[model samples]
Target: ASITERFEPAISWDQVARLREIWKGAMVTKGPLGAQDVVRAVELGCDGVYLSNHGGRQLDQVAHPLDLLVAARRAVGRKTTILLDSGIRCGADVAIALACGADYCLVGRPYLYGLAAAGQAGVEFVIGMIAEELGRTLQLLGLAGVADLKAAGEGVVRYGGSPASRPGDTGDFGVLQ
Candidate 1:
């Protein structure tokens, strides 16, 4: 699809399951979409939807996760969870995701970096680092577990909302989109 096309290129709802892919290098590229893909996901009794573009890595010049978040939420409504993960790098990303009606967020690159650095140990270290940071953050803000956060994550500030909203952007097509 062109960068200018949002939903204009949409296919029918029944054809997405049979969607085809185009291979490039070692990558598998998706053909296109059908609305029933979303509806089918709903009919299959999903609790939520994930509106991520693999951190923009799956396809070049594709929209980022945040850019797709609002529309996805509007499609799924409040009954389902709308989780996001693509380029989230810090606590601020998590905060914005929650604020924008996302039920959950995941950090892909950070853990991957940890994994690259030291395998399982690197992953554990990253988790420990996050735990330590959260502890310090909670202590400074007088907050408890994540469930204890209010409008924001206590001491953490918003990263000025999602990263995709900025001007002069192409698209992020790396880190699994």
Candidate 2:
């Protein structure tokens, strides 16, 4: 059977609250995409909210995780730490996620790719490349750290398509609030 089918696929609120009562360390819930679910996780005592689409492996046509970050942040406010994963292959991707409101990004495939390509050296190379790109992105955006990304907001990243791809002659499109 598949991994999803092998285990109990459903979770209950009582189970989450009970587990939180028994655990000493931080508790987090992963793969929740809705703002209401994020808010509910906080109510259930989750220390963090992990936004993911299972790397787009679990379902088709799900919203991009980055696109959901802002709503999740608004739903939970600043009290809960919101994290994101999936489709993050580089440092710039990391920066974009943060600017969109993710407190942290969890990378999986990039590390796995590095490991499969050349072991330790490849892993180190990938890490260094991401760090370098992060630094350059910060400098170019005139920001000092990742925390400053919150202020950069939606203008820092562009979704949809290239500017030239738009057929209109007007330059009056405003940022979505």
Best by TM-score: 2
Model 1 clashes, total count: 12
- The whole-model lDDT of each prediction reads 0.53, 0.76
User: What does the lDDT read for residue 109 in candidate 2?
Assistant: 89
lDDT of candidate model 1 versus the reference: 0.53
In order of appearance, the predictions have TM-scores of: 0.56, 0.83
Per-residue alpha-carbon lDDT of candidate 1 for residues 32-112, written as tens digits (9 for 90 to 100): 122234445665444445666677676647656665555555566666666677777655455555545567777788888
Clashing pairs in 2: none
> Model 2 reaches what TM-score against the true structure?
0.83
What does candidate 2's lDDT look like per residue over 1-177, in tens digits? 888888878888788889999997999998776888888889989999888988888754787677678778878877999889988888778777777778888888888889899999888888888888877878878889886767876566544422212344244322221
Give residue 176's error in model 1 in angstroms: 26
Kindly provide the TM-score of model 1 when superposed on the true structure, using C-alpha atoms: 0.56
Candidate 1: segments with Cα more than 4 A from true spot: 1-12, 16-46, 134-145, 148-177
